[model samples]
Target: MDKDISEITDKWKNMNQTHIDTDEKIGPYLDKYFMKYKKTIYDSALSLFYALDTRNLRKSHKHEPISIQALKCFKDFVDRNQATIEEAFLEQKVILPACQFAIYRESETWISTICKYYHVESLPKADRIRLLQKTVNEKKFSSAAWFAIYAKVIREFNLQDIYVPLICQTRISVVEQLMKQDPAIAQDVVACMDKYIDNAGELASFARDIPGANFCLLNDKGIAKFAKRLAREYKVPIQICPRIDYNAKMNAIKFLFRRRYEQRKPMDKRTWETMIDSVFDLDSPASEDNNLVLELIYDLTNYQQYEEARRLAHLHRIPENKWPKLLLSNRSSPDRPLSRLGSGKIISDRNPKLVSVEPEKYSVDLPDDKIFYINSHEKFKEMNSYITKHPLLAIDTEWKPKLGLLNECNPKAALVQIACQDRIFVVDAVELCRDSEWATFVNAIINNPNLIKLGFSIHNDLRAISELIADMNIETKPESFIDYAQFHKSLVQAFKIPLPDYPASSGGLSKLAYTVLGKYLVKDDQYTNWAMRPLTTDKIIYAATDAYVLLEIHEKLESWCQERAINYEVLMKALLKKDSTKNKVNIK
Candidate 1:
């Protein structure tokens, strides 16, 4: 026994000397210490662990037999190597062993480490609860340590055997911490506590022990029976039952605000106050829906509570754009549209801001020999041949204008016009959508890497194509496509052109044609129903012009960009990158 003790002490001294002389890493020192003193190192291991720089042990690691000093030391390690430790802990193999170490240690810090490292789903229920129990039971009843351990145990191991008993015995401080950590667990814990307390007298006794036991937090999930029992016992009726269902309250508030706005219903101060009180709880979450909150701010403007409205806006985190500043600025005046002439209708259209182009300046007389109407499979094959022959094709889709109520109309493409050099083919969308051959041919063209598809507002056309494809249960996206609208924007930005301002998704065929071809593409039949069969000659020519003009504009734009020393390839790539980013879902 004396020999073993001497050997352990010598190993510790040597380890310390090595550690001090050359700042050695922890893993290497531990490896050597255990190897040399493997047989009798159990008693001296803690001392050796303490002697070395404890900074090597990451916070994610479950360092056993936790002391205040060790915990403090481990915290520093956690701070320094957080990302690395977190990454390693994410591995499935790493979690089990770390959790096992935490269990063996029977430590509050270790249990927390497990919770931090492994998700509840990743952990085995039996092992997690067992470790939780070991750590929690080892903690002293009334310290900060106990509160932390109890909270972790309750959160991590909510199984009835472990959770119910611990929650019933736990003091209010620990319960409060648990509630703050996870309100859902607090709900469960309160329910369990109520079950154990049984009669009103016993519950009152528990409440007396901890005066700050706020039972209001647990006023959810039919636990109202327990709350009512306690209230009856106290004779004050604490009014904890029928707790504010936040989501339902928000929905109601949103509906009311919508009605007030749409119906132009004047809401009185008393009614507004009642609406606010129903949704707003001083103790509960203040901000639920920013839209409804913004509406509430506007309503508050009617009440002349400007400062209070601003304060509420800030609390709800409503965006600065939605602040109702204009409404607030004109709060005293009657809300009505002003016109130059009294009782006269407001003419919305003013003088055209865009530079007008003559049709004859850029009109091309199409050779009747090349332009082919491809409605049948035979014409489609001939069009496919033309598509294969050409490296680039200008494409356009015309859809029937969706009419009627916004929600009732079904919109679809009526014409798909493809222009390849000399040949222009107008495929009937309604007829072509039914043919499997047409689907395969269309897929080939759209997905071809060698062929470039040129269009104006390409996303709109793509969306129309996607909708049509969905009807046939075929999914496709144009692989090599350029939106002239996107290109024009990038060109203006890159070349510093002094052109008239054109809104995004609006700088379409007419704008491009006017800018590049020096001619306005006529849009007389633009909104006409393209889905009607026995199509007009004027409609066919209109559809053909829209497709053919894209190629002309594209060539002109490319040449114009290249002449100015702008890297056309790099510029298009940048524009496409911007387009792709713009298409991404903005989640707010």
Candidate 2:
């Protein structure tokens, strides 16, 4: 019997090698040769081999798609094991991925089998969307792989123009719970923002409704951005600004403007000057309240809404006895002082330094002792001790640009620059990726809520590399990542200033650095091949400047928050909650 089994196995091997073992051959081979020895180890081992081979087995005649071929193999495996399927999954486990792979290709058989498997009764519910929505049954709907797959189905199916409540509805129902455990999961959904635009409003609204920010991933800046975009799309002026600490040196006039902007009462912004003219007339209570009229002029002037300030001041007939000055002669800039009304208060005292510093003054000057470029595996091991002690870090990555047509593929990562205080560690990702402990090291800093990781448009830098994402297993885990780009938007929305230099929709790192730190980042090296050995001096500086400048930019923004009485750490820490009480209450 042993000799006979060896002979059958040899034929199986030969059949598999030549690609002659089609779905047709596998059945007979399993039935005729292996059927007689079902109880032996050969039956189990050989059965395992043949099941794997069957899954990949193609139909020789029809040239069916891989999805169909796998589905057929799965059906066969189930049919043959129907008697024992309820008791054991030894063979079922081998072919299950076939069903999963089938989700990619649209087929009747694929649809039918899923219905029977899940006991799904409705035909429409078992369709592509229902299955896409059914992914909520998994540990979480935010799986990066499923997010990609579902997005592909949505795009390929041309569901963009039509609003799909079911999509965001499914996500919204469970995200609070999912976020409680992993708030970073919101980052994944936000990462796929371009692919899921149809329901951006619903998603943003749902995010706002999540109540209490801890583990509420969707409520972050990305969704806030989408909310603002939707408002723009509908031709409405949105005031989706982050919470400002009113008690802490906040401008009362600015706060009132923000609150009123939320109501959108002055919908016709084109004619707002004509309308506000009447609201601040002498007969109106605004004129009687001296502080109200003066601050209104101050708020308008501060944001460079000078025409409105001029209109308000002259229209109200600023009496010399009232408080504050109105130097309307030179309302061209915030720097120009306002002349006094009756009460002797000057507007310049309340004016903050709201503009970027001179471009020439902005520089990233790191001493030789401060910069560490690690290119060797030995040097990579020493990285943790150097970086882990700091509670705040500014990180940026560099990679070889992809010259090929497949731009979707991630670039090969070369360097990961981490800046803290006076020290900057330019860790070579190529060498570190080879180390088994590399992912652990990365997660320690990025996922550590106690440690703040700053990046500009950060999700793209970390998520673009599939190889690194898999190595680090960070997709589902909550990343305590602070995307300054979104923060910049919050600042713009709150301040309502015309940022003429860059696109209003985005906060590019260079623009942020220039505006916040008065330093313009030289981005010529951005397109260069980063994987080259013997790193050039220009590459090192360019990389170091990107990471190092973030530290200063963050400090400037932090001061802005402090001046407004906003707690920067509290906002960041809110997103990093590892677990939430809400999860235990509603999660089933």
Candidate 3:
């Protein structure tokens, strides 16, 4: 006990007085003292008691158990230093073991002493509920614990009117523990529990009435039935939720075909045959997926059955505009495995084999207007004047892809893409990078807080721009930027959407293009060297389309949120929360 006391005193002496106000140091000090002394064998007839106050201390050994004596000491200390104890509690200095002392002694006054420091209305919802849980479940002080929980419920109700569901749905053990000593509250508790469960089921049914609520996992059978009925009546496509069994997938497929056939829009024969074969082809040396829509289309194309493949597209109602990219491209490639070096980063020996593409056939739907090429100072100045007036612009940049993770080559900015409502300006960063007008134009868009700059995965783009600005010796600050990829993730987690997990760092631009525009964006030129001079017509269209489409996608997202009654400001707050340990942005 002397050594434990000395160690704790040393820890306190080592800590600066300023840091004593922080809760971080108190837990360790208490933990060491308790670990050493509480576990030591002591005389059964006498137990140690130590009391600490700002101005005095009391120490004794009595016939009572150590925990009981400790509780008495704590009460005396609290009586003398009520303000200090409350402040300590607010700092979280009073830990579970200390609470255990008061609970084991069954001292209502001590419990009240602790409760006065914590108020439900003063804390966040989660924190307040956690405090209540600790108080109730700390020990078998059933009467005092129940009173605290019941009071907390009333306080929470007064604050937000959100307490009924929480109190009613609290763990059954809590109710059982409270009711063992207080049978008078049993009837009221059980009624609240039943009401909470019934209300939950009704909420699930209401959610199912929304169009995209297929993303929600429905546990209630009646709600699932309601969703299925709505899907059938509205002729909506059946979306598969997670954990679906083989039989469930088969039934959904059958239901889809039956509805389509009744409407005289029966699926094509070849496509149906292909779908059946893929569903039951578990023995085949390929991936197991029930849909097989993409695999079947590719197989038909590989067999040179273009006529039948095109007919399948027609039957599926694939927009004539979207069919070519959906059915035309080859994506399967041998993975370019990476090798590691001394720096603990992955690097590849060689790049992946590039697939052949017809540059002449590459096209993107754009306005029937000429794209401005700002290679000279005068054109650069003119473009900047036109773009700075718009409150919103879709922005993007082009740079040569890094050869490897640890590739030592310093990347040079290739192009800067800025698109407004009617025009796109593709700046030649190689030529205009040193020009003052170009730097000024870039500064205006990035630094203006009121000007909304929209992009996909803007982190890398900002880094590249930073590098470019540094080389030009320009001081600029970027603000009011929106990365749609992060926005999509916020929406997904917030709405509990059942989309497949995408790579967390990527923009998922290809998926967004298909979802929002109802067409595919050609990505064959994605990783090509953008620094090459005399850019091909295909590359020019790809660059312009990449920037221009962000504006269109933003419009679609706004409408989607408005239709679903999602508050845009509230959704953005979720995306801005940073995980301190991982240094990653996360949905709060």
Candidate number achieving the greatest lDDT relative to the actual structure: 1
Candidate 1 wrongly placed segments (more than 4 Å): 1-364, 403-410, 471-477, 497-507, 565-588
lDDT of 3 by residue, 165-185 (tens): 222233234435443433334
What TM-score, to 2 decimals, does candidate 1 have? 0.41
Summarize candidate 2's per-residue lDDT along 483-535 as a digit string, tens digits.
77666665556544344453232237877876776556665445444665667
Q: How high is the CA lDDT of each candidate model?
A: 0.53, 0.49, 0.49
Top candidate, metric TM-score: 1
TM-score of every candidate:
0.41, 0.38, 0.39
Q: Which digits, one per residue and each the tens of the lDDT, describe model 1 over residues 476-548? A: 7566677776666656765675554332323357766766666666654565557667677767888988999
> Clashes in model 3: which pairs?
none
Better of 1 and 3 by lDDT: 1
Off by over 4 Å in 3: 1-365, 368-370, 405-407, 496-507, 567-588
- Weakest 10 consecutive residues of candidate 1 by summed lDDT: 236-245
Q: By the TM-score metric, which is better: model 1 or model 2?
A: 1
Residue 60 CA displacement from its true place in model 3, Å: 25
Candidate 2 lowest-lDDT run of ten: 240-249
| lDDT score, candidate 1 | 0.53
